[model samples]
Target chain A: MAEEKIRVLIAKPGLDGHDRGAKVVARALRDAGMEVIYTGLRQTPEMIAEAALQEDVDVVGLSILSGAHMALLPKTVQLLREKGLDHVLVVAGGIIPDEDVPKLKEAGIAEVFGPGTSTQTIVEYIRNKVAEIRRSRKNA
Target chain B: MFDKEALEKIKERQEQWEETTLQQWLARLPERDELFRNLSDMPIARLYTPADIPDFDYLEELGFPGEYPFTRGIHATMYRGRLWTMRMFSGYGSAEETNERFKYLLKHGETGLSVAFDTPTLYGYDTDDPMAEGEFGKCGVAVSSLADMEILFDGIPLDKVTTSMTINAPAAILWAMYLVVAEKRGIPWTKIGGTIQNDILKEYIAQKEFVFPPKPSMRLIVDTFEFGAKYVPKWNTISISGYHIREAGATAVQELAFTLYDGFEYVKAGIERGLDVDEFAPRLSFFFNAHNDFFEEIAKFRAARRIWAREMRNRFGAKDPRSWWLRFHTQTAGCTLTAQQPENNIVRVAIQALAAVLGGTQSLHTNSMDEALALPSELAVRIALRTQQIIAHETGVVNTIDPLGGSYYVEYLTRKMEEAAYEYFRKIDAMGGMIAAIEKGFPQKEIADAAYRYQKEIDEKKRIIVGVNEYVSDEPITIPIHKIDPEGERRHRERLARVRRERDNERVRQCLERLRNAAQDERENLMPYILDCVRAYATLGEMMKVLREVFGEYREPIII
Candidate 1:
């Protein structure tokens, strides 16, 4: 049987036109032997979640630069839950303040990568998370 | 005098670590090649020296400020005579909402106004248009007609303050709308001062916000130059921009080289249109990105001025000194801001803004701290503006012109940057200029390759991003984020509907028909006809649709 490649969707939510980080992350993920899909700038949360569901990726990374995280992040998490995509790991990045990480975690975000975070750390985190999911599913 | 023994001791220690010379090392590592790195990579050498720029000529390469080959600055006083304009780029929701923001920015010590239009408005769409669904007032303010334009400006006097509009593709139509509004306010076109980011080359290169293909876009730009020279004498017809290019992941050198290449292309286009080079050249301005590398960013700006001056005077045969001067506006790199440590963005923006000031920007926009989170809250914007203010007043660097000009490091880097830029220009020329290169996927590929290399280095731990790799942060975020009103879109659509129901439909139809006719006719200037449509209260979508039918939409040739 052919090895099933890990697929990831990197998306930018809302009016934020800042996508350098997202593009870099996408490129890094692709290089790390994962199949990456990048949703270009100015995507809505609805659009992002829908893309995640349609693409059926192992991981979904939401890059938010417009500071609408509190309002937008909850909507995406809720959408994912409603879509029965709780198994798909959700990670948020961009200029998120230190104090909001707990709030985001509470909202079901798996991890938060701030500025200066290395691409390797993110890739490794996804790899570990995906393996954990696989182990849990096999036991079930 | 006694350092010889110390140097010998240091050399012995260095030899212990690595005994081979550079040449021997290169021989062993034949795969290692040095020249130009691809677009996305963090530059291999963070700091350059005299060895990097050996053939530096002060008189020929970097002449004094306000002189020929103006590498140091455009003006003698630069910021001393007048500090760079603190222009806040503001817009959101409807015309009325943006108008309020404009006034608020001006009241809060903003020197100039830079308008940001909603995607629909940018693409010349009316809020009520079906294609404009869900994007009416999310990104920027929507201005569909002269009525909207008038409401957008309201009590603001166009004659007194300069306004820069970040719009392209449908720039002529939007400019026409501004002119009609100015005319209504009894302000002659000559009295209005501002810049139009009418750079379509960059649209093809990085932004991907283009409407027409290259040839027609160039024609439209030339038409604006001709029209602006005749009427809006104080206005800058085109802002050759590298801000978008940098934001799209280009290095400082690529941003400098590509932006200047675009500017040169526009000049060439203008000459072909039979306009005297000096007549329109003085009005041409630039916009750049102030990224993380402080000294490198400064060197890029200095190199840009020198290269522009030499090319305009020597290559283009322009006689006017004003034509040689390269004035620019800068915005701190929004890409550099981190969402994890949102408060850190304030420090980052401060450093970037200072780099811009030292580099001699005519205008500047400091990104708000909460930018990476959402549209900047009012409080966040105020802090961003204050960043510029503190630099202007508290920082004494502005007291001296080009304070870092003669520094060994700055001078060397400036030359290196200029040389690297020329090398890129030569390559682009070989590929048949920017248009031909772009078509062949040259620039796109170059950028992508560089981006890939940079990412690889970060992954391998060759590059150390301060907060990212080495320093671990387990802390959560606590910054306040700005929230967009959910009702904003509904309110905008209702207002657009009301305007359509109330406006003179017949007049709108006639004006739009004229615009369409003008667009179809190659010889006719589209400005006057567009002005008429604006005066008729024709929605942006209506006018754009007509032109879109005439010009057809441009589809980018994806390279990567």
Candidate 2:
């Protein structure tokens, strides 16, 4: 297959410093044959968005556990949009509450995977989103 | 308790029974899985018997409560006389908001207050600092100066309550602010009883909240040890913690070994600083995580007491009986709480809290159900506190000291944990102690490997985290999670600005300069200088800035 591996950037966008899930997901994505860039802990939204654009990745995964998701995630999504990287499939994972899932979705995050979500589910979702982005771009 | 001949006869009989009775049962029924194991993948037997721990000596290993090698307990009466302090860790948003929450917890029957500082405070930054942007009051209560500390504890009498500030890196400054607040309240430093989580080694190894280099950080910690021993005698100067290590995904044995090693390192630092082992050793306390593995957690606690007691007495030559005590505060594992089916966390907290209590924790903090989502709402915190209360009052396990002390399985597991810890200790000693081991990423690699294995277990369905991988739920979380106001940052910044404007600038500058001098000096205790800055109403950011200029900021070497 001549298809390039789908690039994904896994970033910790807050001061939570909990990267276990982030690292696990990154490993899973890498094992699933995706190119992944992990920005370490205490990343600001600008740092994440800048890295996402610079890496030119297809998916940006935000891992936050400091209970600052509502404040941080939305800003991250908005920053990505401002950088014209809206097509960068924005996915989030961590200790995100259920009520905030819809809010995160509304903020332009494509999917919010809370705790207990298998990497397979996350991988499948990212593949689907990346495929959708590619198809749309090809049509355009 | 069995005689040697009887023990030999019983072993032979048990072997015969296993070959016949157990084999017959196994032939009829398939075991649930190929192998039974704990979270660490340690092979666990289906049943434990005297054969598992044949040479178990209760008097030698697990002496009575309040005795040497206190595998049973540190307290004589245990919960029969009084329950473990329900010290709920609570804080979020501004100082005023956290103060209200403190009063709320107190009114609801919380015995002690554990202050959870926000990320900014933890990293030694004021709320208004550019580095603190978008992070004010996000994780815990944000207090930048003595003004905020005073407001945070407003109406909460300093002498009446014990507060545990979960602050590292800038522990001295934060603690000094605390002492100055109490002083302003007319309470002497000696009268203040609480703890500062001045455990920086674990910060480098696990939490990653470290500010200064290891040498300077150790110096600052020793300063607190000397000062606490001389001035604030009742205060637990350092809560050598394994809570974060476990939360960072360490197995029970790693948590036990690594935490004890950190404690031993502190004892070494104190001795090297020319302080008597007994003077500060008694004031040294410990904090451990009560994770889900019930029996294993209980075993870990028992092993911890034994290891600490032996090390303190035999190795360190601490003569005071109090110095030999491994008094600890336990918080149920927050990492175990699932955001999915949030209410299930309540049950999980209760079980872990029960384990901590059974393990003889001097104090306990039960994680609220909504913690995975947010800090915790009022209702969630009450339930968490009630979980502890119910375990203490309703559960009759606390009626007797070391209620599970005599269980064959528990004893077996405790011995296993102790042996595992000794193995790690040997490995660490070979690597030139905990600091060198940490520099080489020993504990970090261990925790990462354990975390990876644990995650793999969950992914492969080998390990079942009730609401997580096993009893999966898609139920919408209906529980209210506490959301820090987005405006909290603006308000906090304004308050910090006001503090900076109102405080005497000359005194603040002088105090910071003095602190800088002391931080640069190998001989001077930095606590007094830090306290002077706190008295001058210097902000945490400013004081930390001076020290950062003097001691240099620490950049953690990346671990692959």
Candidate with maximal lDDT: 2
| Candidate 1 ranges beyond 4 A from true positions | A7-22, A37-118, A121-140, B1-56, B455-461, B470-476
**For candidate 2, lDDT tens digit of each residue in B439-507?**
898998898788877887888887788878777766777888677666766777788889889989999
DockQ values, each candidate = 0.22, 0.52
TM-score of 2: 0.96
DockQ of 1: 0.22
Q: Quote the lDDT for A62 in model 1.
A: 92
Error of 1 at A71 (Å): 11
Instruction: Provide the overall lDDT of each model, using Cα atoms, as 2-decimal numbers.
Output: 0.82, 0.89
Q: What does the lDDT come to for candidate 2? A: 0.89
Candidate 1 lands at a TM-score of 0.84
Instruction: Say what the interface RMSD of candidate 2 is.
Output: 1.9
